[model samples]
Target chain A: MTSTTLTPSFDEQYVATRKVATVGRVEISDVTKSYGANTVLRDVSLTIEPGQVVALIGPSGSGKSTLLRAINHLETVDRGSITVDGRYIGYERKGDTLHELREAEILRRRTQVGLVFQNFNLFPHLTAIENIIEAPVAHKRLTRDDARALAEGLLARVGLADKADHYPRQLSGGQQQRVAIARALALSPKVLLFDEPTSALDPELVGEVLDVIRGLARDGTTLVIVTHEIGFAREVADRIVFLDHGEIVEQGTPGQVLRNARHRRTRDFLAKVL
Target chain B: MSRIVAPRSETTAHAAGAATPATDADATTDDTTSASSATADAVAKSGPAGGRLDAGLRVVPVKHWGRWVLSAIVAFVILQFLWSLATNPQWQWDVFAEYFFAPSVINGLWLTLGLTVVAGVAGFVLGAVLAVFRLSKSPLLGAAAWWYIWFFRSVPLVVQILVWYNLGYLYPTLGLGTPFTTDFWIVEFPTTTLISAFAAAAIGLSLHQAAYSAEIIRAGILSVDQGQLEAAGALGLPRSIRFFRITLPQAARAIVPNAFNEIIGLVKGTSVVFIVALPELFYTVQVIYNRNQRVIPLLLVAVVWYALITTVLSIAQYYVERRYARGSVRELPPTPVQRARRWGAEQWNRLGDAHTAAAPPPPAQPEPVVTAAAAASDQYRTGGAA
Candidate 1:
């Protein structure tokens, strides 16, 4: 399932040409989000460096998915700010105040950060390849022909070359998730986020999707994955952040947070999951 | 009885790929007696003949006496009504045929179709704009759209038509100028000259239809999965692209059937435009009948034309719905023509078998394998079975 045909080309493109191509540094500072009285993210702060893959692992209500979505500005934060490559996603700083950018401006910036949903959420009406090419073409980032080629390349990279014309419903959960990964890659986003990519998949199908993500990590693309796959996190992630009760409890290399967690809450959480 | 049992058992035994149980009785009866070897196999398996009938058990079809009685009554009523129509001279079948395709009547038919098309398109366009406005975040826009829908839907259509026709009474001239002032009229035209009977009818029908179309389009947009919008937004697609490419296509699956329903209603709704003196089909029929004193036949002509128009629309709706059904339904339901073609092929194959008298049984179809594709297809089937 892990064919490395297209990764070499992507690696060269990211590592060679563009200045911020390989370095999609994500900065999240004091980000707090709340829904009425229910606080979901409590001043959560984390930084992911160039080419780094960070896995956010926690319980259901631990705000892991919210943090990932907020990175892409999918969820608005009540306090603090998030930036990729030192540029705000949903806002622009003017003088002393942070002014929220207009919808068009925000959409322009959102192209740099792509989010994959837990449900795979591939557009049902479009075929897999069309779904991949739609955003890039619509945003004018690529010509239709170029977008199609990129889409085909991405599809091959994810091991679904023959499924270009197949609809989402025609694909297995694993195949659909793989196509979602290809779709996110088609935008050539500087930062790619996965909000529990494999959570909705069948147990046996999880491996195929994870294998594709592992290939992405090796291609020098910055990735932030919210996942329950602890073993997968250990194998691919450069940093693993353990969150509990809407706060980051422990942050370190997988060996530290997983093997010798300092906090008792982290230890208890690990004890249950392990 | 022995002969009948022997062939029946052979056919039932060799009826490959048929569903089991209740419906099997009818299906087995239709099966050709071309599998005599299979009959011998059944006899060999049945131990011994009891009373020169060792083929298979008798299968009595489950009977519905109520259905029989109801169908008989319905058929008798339909036949009697048709008999009366043929026997009665008041129908004026000759006069009906004469004007049914006459030049003047045909022109009226064209006018009806033209009005329906123009008003339908204009209504949907305005409705789509209003639906977007209603769904927008600005309260002012939403309230304005709401008010427009309310006003248009509240007034009776005929009254609206008359009001539009008599718009000159309210405003002698329509002009583009500063609000609340006629000092510097940029461009002006007399209301009567601009609002002809046909124009008034078009405006009235479109406005009346727009209110319903707005609700239909809005409900259609709302019917789309929230996740679809999120996915489009996450892709960084522009709002226009999001609406046209992502939301509208999915929403179309919900919108089309209801939209066509409204359009079909509008086709008949155009009949009421006779008040404005527009020469549409129903109005032309009224005019001809008033002059010739042949009311029933002329009315029948108009009825036949309306039925024809609606039939064409219904057929078009089916195809349009099938087109929009891509990726939503697991397999497109077979079209009627496709069903007929398949049935004809089966009948032709049965005829071929009838000639041979000892044709070999059709080869058994392989059991369908439950692969990942099948499981995924089943998932979509259940999810979208609605």
Candidate 2:
């Protein structure tokens, strides 16, 4: 008759840790996305651990980038569900019925998922510090002083403390990318998504940006990077996923996947890449 | 065998000089290498020729000859028309001076300017409000704004003035003298006795100007980037602050130029108020022409004044636009000459101050020195430098 008999002994401890880690884990279940007759992602299912750095790699039109965008609800999925920190994003389920989340709700959820685009879409008019503190002050209702302090700290962390007052147009591509990363981190997001953060950068500048991202991975931040930098993936990523034609053809540790791929498509991809 | 042996000897000699070999294996290698090198050289040269040909075909510099010819034709036509007008025997200078230079017409110019200023200010404020209302999300407000714009725009200025001037006929008492009305609540019957022609003209002109100003304001607002609004929203700026601070400040650059044009239009449109006998420049000219019958000269006076006023307005508009454009442009700093003059003035002022501070000792002498320095400074301060 006692509730102690019904519950597990470590329920309290488990609940507390679960609540803490719930801030970071992103789960995608049977997620499928399509544009009219063309499907981008088909029945893609993946679970990213709280601090795991996942690299999504594939040839062009392979749906790797689409899956990353779907996780943030930038693109609506045709089927299935994506959940971040146990909260349903883009779609809500109620008593066996599912409905797409409203725009306001999606915006609220997007605050928790930070996306860094390849183009470094920093508001050109605002200074780097202004861009970094924009969301915190506006969306989170943080005081200007607090937001400024946090933004300054993040800018320093990204090695752009001196460039905080500079406009996006004045900074070099690498510096802009770093500022963008700082801007994303200012929100204290649960997950950071990088959409080829260095693909648009000059070859000489690419290494510096990749270094910042690698440093982020080391700090145990949950990251989903869609990238062409296979070397970075091999070195920093906890799990490397190879996608092909809207399907996850193979996924494993970088060594098992990059060097000893079992699937023929993965083998062919590695063969060409190596 | 004899024929093959002679060719092989020639090939072997060619290979031996290159220090490879003179064997049959070398012979086949030499043949393949010679053929492939010749093919590659031909292809490389041919590829560039095609590219060069395409480049040559694509190179078409713009020609200004057609524009030059069109401009010359237009100039000739304008000159011919002006020549006819100048040579006409019917050009009456005396008649022009009698009506155009009349004192009444001068007063009309002042009246015209005053009316335009009043109407333009009222219309612009009303128009801005209507534009904001039209852009609002509430259906009722949007519909009301649209309806107001439509109604005002559809009616002619002359008709509006006539209706307002004659409003006394519609409501004899001006609805102010009901028996039950308290002294505070009572409305006076000013429509019949107090409604002047100037009042009617202002009301009519302001209503018409408001409609056009609304369109200009709406276009300016729409020209702003959506990202700016989003950025402001993200900053958590309140709705009103976001609009006035972020959105309107940016839109000012676009809005100012058009608003200037509308002001000039309002000034010219004031001439239409002559129908209501508001005694504006054109109406004053009409009065002179009525007495003297100097039709052409009187009309010319009004035309000249309008041109002069418009020219001044245009210059003012240019400076205002330049000021607003500083938001985007990186202006050059003042020249060294300007800086030097500024420094000289400052030094002179300091000297004057020192002299004044030593006052009672040599008051008269320092006064003269200060005057001399000021005169010198005044000479250098030409072109409104200050």
> Which model scores highest in TM-score?
1
Q: Over the stretch B178-293, how does candidate 1's per-residue lDDT look in tens digits?
A: 99887537899999998999999999999999999999999999999998888888988999999999999999999999999999999889988899888899999899999999
lDDT of 2 by residue, A1-274 (tens): 1112223234233223322244589989998888889988999999999978899988889998788878777667888888888787666778888777765666666777877878786665567898887677766558989999999888877777787788777788988888888888887778999988989999988877876776666556799999888987887788999999999999999989998899999988877776
**Structure candidate 1, residue pairs in collision:** none
| lDDT tens per residue, model 2, B1-386 | 34443443344334333433324334444444555434333323333223222211233355899899999999999999899777875657666666565677778888889888988998989999999999999999899999999999899888998998898888555554546653425555557576788888888888888988998888888988775654343323455656765667667778898998889888878988878777888878778778877677778888888899899998888677665554353343554567799999999999999988786655545677777887887878863443
Q: Which stretches of candidate 2 lie above 4 Å from their native place?
A: A1-22, A90-93, A98-103, A267-274, B1-386
- So what's the TM-score on candidate 2? 0.58
Task: Evaluate model 2 with DockQ and give the value.
Answer: 0.08
Native A-B contact fraction in model 1: 0.72
TM-score of 1: 0.83
Could you report the DockQ of all the candidates, in the order they appear?
A: 0.66, 0.08
lDDT of 2 at B77: 100
Please give, as one word, the docking class of candidate 2. incorrect
